[model samples]
Target: MRNNEMHEAGQGVLEDGHGRRFYYLRLSVTDACNFRCDYCLPEGYRARAGEAAPLSVAEAATAMRAFARLGTRKVRLSGGEPSLRADLPDIIAAARNTPGIRRVAVTSNGYKLPKVIDEWRRSGLDQLNISIDSLDAAEFARITGHDCLPRIRTGIDRALELGVQTKVNAVLLSDGATERLQQFLDWLRDTPVTLRFIELMQTGDNRDYFASNHLRGDTIERQLIESGWQLLPRAIDAGPAREYAHPDYRGSIGLITPYSRDFCQSCNRLRVSAQGKLHLCLFADAGLDLREEIRRGDVAALAERIQTLVGGKAASHYLQQGQTGATRNLSVIGG
Candidate 1:
């Protein structure tokens, strides 16, 4: 099907046998990152390999335009650290101008966000999701292998000051990090930033670390509710996180259980890596290469390939069966 035909056919709505609509696209702008988080990348992992072939800004814009033409209305720019790309604002602008696209967001580690929050807003960014695994100074350094918490906090404050919808993402590891959940929550009580707790997924080169850090969402929620905070439903879309709000709080809480429980039946997003591969599922070991094909000016073939991949997507991820190790690390693929 041609891109416009696919858009009119509503084939890109990506409804499964269960009638769930997949309309979101997560696009990774770069694979390079500055931080070496233990859970995301193994300790002492080589930061540089042979120079990797990343998609050019124009190529990324082409894929985004094609996705938009096929009914994708939401696109989130992600990366090993998306902010590292100097042309990030341009990418956001291109996606914003794409047909059928309604929202443009970015997920960053927040190390360099304080300086660019204003530019991001001016460039048509609708939202920002910052990854902050720990609030404590020393513990955060241990988790991210960097002393960037202060800068990250400043970036969050800047986002709030600029009136951007912001969310703080934290991953629950088996290192007893959940014990400090209340501390993080209390610190954010006065801010408008929502807190999201993510279960450590079994991916990348950190199998041993993930195996030790896997914490269930139910346990974390029960612990928080018992600590005198009320949890209320706050999910506005059909994404993985189950969001909740508390009485007398300025923000809310989001819990994502991709490993403990699979939400794949309602999975509505497609991931495009920095190398221009289309990943149907975050845990899938393989993906369809669209960069080369799209550059050849074959829009019809590209749309058909995407439809076939989505149709063949697995009902759920394999993490529940103790499976780990994807073809690429989370940084390269974009979570």
Candidate 2:
């Protein structure tokens, strides 16, 4: 039987005190990115002089094994930009080889995708999530501080050709969001990829930027619905996006409205930083150190530690209250 089917047949599951079960794990492979997106890292990524390196191949494997054994079926490798890792393919293979991990995915900026995507796919990458904030080349460059949108587009086409499940993420900004939406929808009329519009969130370092650029996701959601897009039911292991499909378009749209009411009620995923700390919520006040258990190489202890930590997860993130917790910036936790 397929590993996912076996997991569905009643294996152990990870549940928090609020009774939410986790089936997805977003693991950061590194905290460094090449992009200087305005909402994320406006000045680009700088390596900390005395910071410890990210998890080793064996350590990543151990963490994945523990989660898989506890009913986590999907593992997404994230980062400030995950593709920056020279050994990312090795990490992908390790996750794929885990006994109960049914899917291995990666979220990248697509800066190096054109060159290394084939290697990643061969290493068992089942899904790819690329960030393409704007469809206009000039505006894209303005936002991402890179004039390589053409190259990123080429890599996306390559991913499509490889039959990799592809999704594109765009941050909704008050400036020109309407125009960007029109461009995205026009492109989606033919492209079969899923385009996800994420609401601009307020991180500790991005307060002023957030205040200036934040756009409510519901406005876009309402517009799509009015245009006859049908809301689709979420999959058992889906992320927090509410997806919609249009009869005349090949692509689908997903809205990630974190500030919307009850947004956290469907939370089914957890994050672990590249530094080996567990974050119960993206905006939580602190992270629990899991590197110690990983260093001991004790799977049982690691699993127990994870479960104990998860049980203390708060019912919801206080984003509406403008509380951003320990997330000084998105890059720190691979948001």
Candidate 3:
């Protein structure tokens, strides 16, 4: 399963049996999150078995170091809320400075950014994706079950004002969030941040939640067009989202349609859960346990194991085939 072709090109970039070279690593640092987004966390999620302990900041860096050396270029930090980790800046710095990792980014709820922005800036963090599903206070509170949208909104504004290359991530819950989505579109018209709407995905625990809240990317675009917005000439090449822009607006909009738009053909990423389980597909439970190998200092074996697992990445996830269950939820797997 070793990718001799990638090695022949230079450094050991991971390539699967399907021939996909993964340059981006979605590294989840913790399975804990501050908010209880209805679609992300199940109603009784925490009542189940406790999560495996997460990697320490240093341990996370070590994992990053290994992946970097194995030719992973970009690493994004995620968590229940990555900002909740105390050593986040250090973790970001470590990933940034890792020899082969070219950039480090973070996915957060943004409520904690006010406290970590300075350290994050100094650490050379490249991108920040704030999970903001709504700009309306009541709607936001209803979705996340937290009355912290004020803080999160302030956090997004601060990140943008501070010159952080920030992006806004919102989930499309078709039934009850149309007004909220429109409000966000109107509000973003004057802001400098790019907004990306992710189509709600279904998982085992949140199946009902997903059903009640799901929205399609195409529906959103139709609304935008009806409201006098134009689709951009081309979508941004990064990630799954098809991009769009407004003629009068400075920023753009992105659509992450994992269900309807199945981006499997262009998939080029891997994920490591906080407790050291390597996930090949976000919606697949199959994973490689790297906790012991990584903790015991066996870099060569760990890399080899990763190569073998990558070789088995399925043609596409079960979710793409209408199956919506996974061993891990989006929060645990780092979204």
Candidate 4:
């Protein structure tokens, strides 16, 4: 797109050496969450919660403004649980107000959204990705360590009733993942919410957990196909997910098989930690410290510097079993 057209579409317009434009920014507002998912947060992470404080809403807004200037068209707020932040509406408002940011989305565990769903909708939340790993109440409790399925269902229903575009993200991270996924699909037969199956990432620092529960997303997709589900392609999509829909179903199914398939050549996003560290890839160890930079310096100059460094983004993440991944887990990485 031309400069004017790019600006019109909220396409930050900055390009790398491969001609890829970074239009999406996954910004982690806070690293705190209410639930302790087995695959995400380590067992002892919550017990030792003496880490440094996260950035304030205003501080995050400043960094977002600079990111907008650098060509970020989409901003997705992610965290341990983004709704855990009291100032989430304000943060959404900041992204909605940013000139180059066309979309503002959030990823949450869906336990805290029912109370303030309308408030967040009013604050310009365009879409939501709710994490719902299982349909059975008991298993859900076992995975998330929270017996709050009723509350999560209530929040999801409330979000849908409020006319918010919402989707479900389920991580395939258990021995009976296929069975649970089939049950989850049965539960979604008449619903309109799109469900996306995410592969169990081995990036976290839990070898035992990875060994016991790491399910290959491709195997699951093939299982679904063998069971007569139609796996079709979407003309338009959001990210790495390949969307699919069954002929007789109202809702859709998608596969985010990042490990089985490589979609890095077209990857067009960056990650900003809750503390303002800029990350090029989810599996990379390198990052730019924007937390201190936000304290002082010209936003435009920072934007220019970041734009110049965009070319350094790795072509693909060399991820394997027991490989060194990002320093932090999914929560801290804003996944």
Which 10 consecutive positions of candidate 4 have the poorest summed lDDT?
4-13
lDDT of 2 at 226: 95
- The true-structure Cα RMSD of candidate 1 reads 3.2
Candidate 3 TM-score over all chains jointly: 0.89
lDDT by residue for model 4 over 197-291, one digit each (tens)?
A: 98877765766777788788888778778867786754322667777777767788888876754567667788887877788888877667776
Best-fitting candidate, measured by lDDT? 2
User: TM-score for all predictions?
Assistant: 0.90, 0.97, 0.89, 0.90
Candidate 3 colliding pairs:
32-80, 33-80, 173-213
**What lDDT tens digits, residue by residue, belong to model 2 across residues 147-202?**
99999999999999999999999999999988999999999999989999999999
- List the candidate numbers ranked by TM-score, top first: 2, 4, 1, 3
> Which regions of candidate 3 fall more than 4 Å away from where they truly are?
1-10, 42-51, 225-237
- Measured with C-alpha atoms, the lDDT of residue 97 in candidate 3 is 66
Better of 2 and 4 by TM-score: 2
Candidate 4 local lDDT, residue 49: 56
What is the lDDT, from 0 to 100, of the residue 78 in candidate 3? 88
lDDT of each: 0.76, 0.91, 0.76, 0.77
After superposing candidate 1 on the true structure, give the runs of residues whose Cα lies further than 4 Å from its correct spot.
1-12, 16-18, 44-52, 225-238, 297-300, 325-328
